[model samples]
Target: MRIESESAKNQWVTAAFECMLDGGLRNIRIEALARALGVTKGSFYHHFANRAELVRAAVERWELEGTDAIIALANREGAPAERLHRLLGVIAGSSAQQGRGELMLFLEASDEGVGDAVARVTGRRIAYVAQLLEEHGVPSGLAQRRAVMAVAEYHGARVIAAGTDSLPVDERVLDVGDAIRFLETTLLAP
Candidate 1:
């Protein structure tokens, strides 16, 4: 079941994402993907040269889609506080969907051969967040720090969320918001 066209490449990428979300990236194998799509390994190769290529595509899609959504929300013309709230919302929402386990898998993948590529996309996301902070008149240095802190806190929240079945949604959201606010006030303040 060789993938016949560019559309088929997209289908393979979609299947790969579903597989990763279901069982993490380690479980994403060419044969498994092909079987899942009712296609042959050759079909996958027709679209992606190999598993690495497919993984790169998946990471690109994740960053592009997630970053785009966050940027759109954060860019809404509003008070600085409102913009920050919306930015936090984007982080919380995306983290909730990704969960801790999936993120750990992604982080591990990021350290492998795919690290540079993932870093490039992730750098863009961070820059976008920093840009929003700067738009609100945050100093350049402080904006950079806050942007990095925001990313770190988001990842930390995912870890915390994953560990406790008893963790309430409000608690997690509050924790995330508090961290963002603290950064905004302390780091981004003049």
Candidate 2:
């Protein structure tokens, strides 16, 4: 594989993402991607050593744009409780955009070569959420547990919403709020 300009590499990464969005990561083939971009497989090889490398880059891009960036925005100059709400809202909005079915697809695909990259990003995201919870007066250990629970709830809600098409964004917000309240009252309270 030969080196290419960063813009060309980014374009390949973007093409890979579109392929994933269309049919999960398995559908992302060098040949297909090249065909989609009106380029040759040689062009893809110039940018990525192999499919794994491309998958890793695509997953890294998703994590940076989707999870880490949203959490950062949520934490910007806000009260602890407000920040938590904003963070939950960000999850809710993303879930709504993804729809429940797509979330399952994403989670399944994350377990592939892309999974490690996703896990790394998710770990950082969880740590950030835990820190925010600690700042809001939760104990450090409990904050960490709550952050994990929050991620679980987000995934669970996506599943639930997918099963029931009628589940609204407001309902998802309420579910997240109730979960936060439970954590506060049951775990965080003295």
- Number of the top-ranking candidate, with TM-score as the measure: 1
Query: How much is the lDDT of residue 85 in candidate 2?
Result: 71
Lowest summed lDDT over 10 consecutive residues: which window, candidate 1? 93-102
Off by over 4 Å in 2: 1-6, 95-111, 163-190
Q: How many angstroms is residue 26 displaced in model 2 relative to the true structure, after the best TM-score fit?
A: 1.4
lDDT of 2 by residue, 19-41 (tens): 66555567668887777677777
Q: Clashing pairs in model 2?
A: 110-115
TM-score for candidate 2, please give it.
Answer: 0.74
lDDT of 1 by residue, 1-190 (tens): 4455657889888777666655556757898888877787788777777787887777666666666666776877787667777776666655444664357555667554667655665687678768777877888887888888777766666676666567664453567556667756764566
Q: Candidate 1, after superposition: displacement of residue 172 in Å?
A: 7.7
